[model samples]
Target: MFDVIIIGAGVSGVSCALILGSAKERPYALNKKIGIITHQKASSLQTAVFNNAYGIPAGKLGSELLEESLAHLSSTYPQVEQIEKEKVISIEDDKTFYKIITNKNVFESKIVVVAIGAGNPMTIEGLEDFVVPHQKVPAIKNRIQLKNNDHLVKDGLYVAGVLAGHRSQLSIAAGSGAAVATDILSLWNDGNHTMVHDAINK
Candidate 1:
């Protein structure tokens, strides 16, 4: 079983994976297994341009940013498995672990983060209860989000990114992902707050 399985490969999901799989003093430092499941399609893929995202060069294509992020995650954290081309269908709570069912395969993990964007309505079986009208981005009437407390849906379950009711902004989504990872790390550290940072070797 994986230590953490993140659903969705958008900015939020990838950012979470990056932190969980980083080579610093944290999850990766502890050799935790991280997995990401996605169908390779994120709302950012359709974005024409990204000029408002922080730290990103102006006039960059949203797709370019996502591609670069994925590439960095893959190359930097080779141990973090990217379960590509798979669409998560449902998530089953199995007491001590979660059974994530996808169109291609089934995965089990100790923790799960749902960062699927709010571009479409959530259809997962056990997660529909948390679905609520998105407070932001009113232009998209069909968009919906999941109710969460600082990205925590319950023990071992979390919601991030747009699905967590955050604005549909790249920086916000990425930050949310990192926040969730930090929370998970804290749990692993016996409730002590944990932070991951890297500095140049001098």
Candidate 2:
């Protein structure tokens, strides 16, 4: 079981893993490889998007930041592993941690961060019936009430970005990731897992 399994390899998930896995005194000091389960391929951030949004000279864009981040992530934490092109179907608890069941493999982690914003499954009527369940058959308004449903046995689960149901921007997602990581780390420290507890606990 991994120390932490972060879903969705978007900016939020990556940022969290980047920060938490790089800690020094942590036993899992090497990143947990933080399971990356996504249905969609992590789109290369268009340099145009950044440039157009932030006036970044329009030329210094395209996968550079992501490339650098990925490189740094690899070089900085030599032990952390990254599994791309994996889509998680469901997250169930395995006593102490969560088990992520994907189409290709299964991963377990003490903590789970759900950063799948609009990426989560949605039932559409016309053509995308197979995407989600019960497309034509309707009950009321929203089909399933997923407020407090936990069939899994995990103890710690965090939600961020759109998955957290917050209409968040890039910076907000980054902060949210930090906050969730801090919370999980706090719990980990309390569980006598690491030295990064004080920063999170306080």
Candidate 3:
């Protein structure tokens, strides 16, 4: 079983994966089996331009940002598995681990983060009870977000990115993802706050 599984490929999802999979510092790293399942598309792809994102160059395509993020995660943390072009059908809590059913395969994990964005509402069995209207974007009807407390939907499950009720901004979504990962790492570190800081070799 994987230690954690993230269900999205947007900026938020990729950011979470980057933090959780980082091997820069051993004491702060999770060093667990992690997997990210994606449909190979993110709502950010629809964005015309991403100029306000902190640290990102102005006038860059959203797709380019996503590509670079994915490339960075892959090259930096090759141990994190990426399952692409697959749709997650449902998630079942098995007491000990979560049984994730996808159109292509079945996987089990100790924790799951839902960062599927707020564009189209995708229904997953057993998660409907937490569904609520997307209040951040009132003009977008039918958009939804999961009820969460500090990104935690319930024990072992979390909601991040715009789906976690954050504004649909690149920096906000990415930061939310990293925050979720830090929370998970804290749990692994016995409730102590943990952070990953890489020191450059001089």
Candidate 4:
């Protein structure tokens, strides 16, 4: 079984996977196998024209930034498995690892991060009202809310990114993703993991 599974290929999901798989003295140091599933490119960012994220010059297209980030991620993390072109059909807890059924394969992971963006509404039992508030527009709704500390969701499930109500900005989404990854790492360390401001410092 994989150690962590991040479901989304957006900035947030990418950042989370990078942190979990590339950190020098954390998740990667412990040899965790991370799997990232995406049906297409990282996110709508590939086509976004935004130019407001930190250090990403005012005129730099979101697509360019995403490309650079992805290239870096690939060169730096060899243990991160990218399951591209596969959409996750369903996720269920089997009393241990999560059973994630995708269009192409089924994966089991000790930890699951649902970083699915808020671009589409996801219907779930009891979350009907929360999924799609403005049915007319049908595009903007908070995906899911996590308990405090973003933990203990069925003993392993975690949520991050726009779906978790974080700002849609690439930088903020990336930060949220890293935060959730840290939380997951902490849990794996038996609550002994301390947050590092940045990987360079640690």
Candidate 2: give its CA RMSD in angstroms: 7.8
How does each model score on TM-score? 0.92, 0.65, 0.92, 0.80
Q: Could you give candidate 3's per-residue lDDT for residues 29-96 as a string of tens digits?
A: 54688999867554556565877889988998877766777788889988999988888889999988
Please give the lDDT score at residue 158 for candidate 2: 68
What is candidate 4's TM-score against the reference? 0.80
Clashes of 3: 0
Clashes by residue pair, model 1:
none
Which is better, 2 or 3, measured by TM-score? 3
Steric clashes per prediction: 0, 4, 0, 1
- Model 3: weakest 10-residue lDDT segment is 22-31
Tens-digit per-residue lDDT, 167-186, candidate 1: 87789989999999989888
Q: Show the lowest summed lDDT stretch of 10 residues, model 4.
A: 129-138
Provide the lDDT at 191 for model 1: 88
After best superposition, candidate 3 residue 175: deviation in angstroms? 0.8
> Superposing all C-alpha atoms, what RMSD in Å does each candidate have to the true structure?
1.9, 7.8, 1.9, 4.1
Using TM-score as the measure, what is the rank order of every candidate, best first? 1, 3, 4, 2
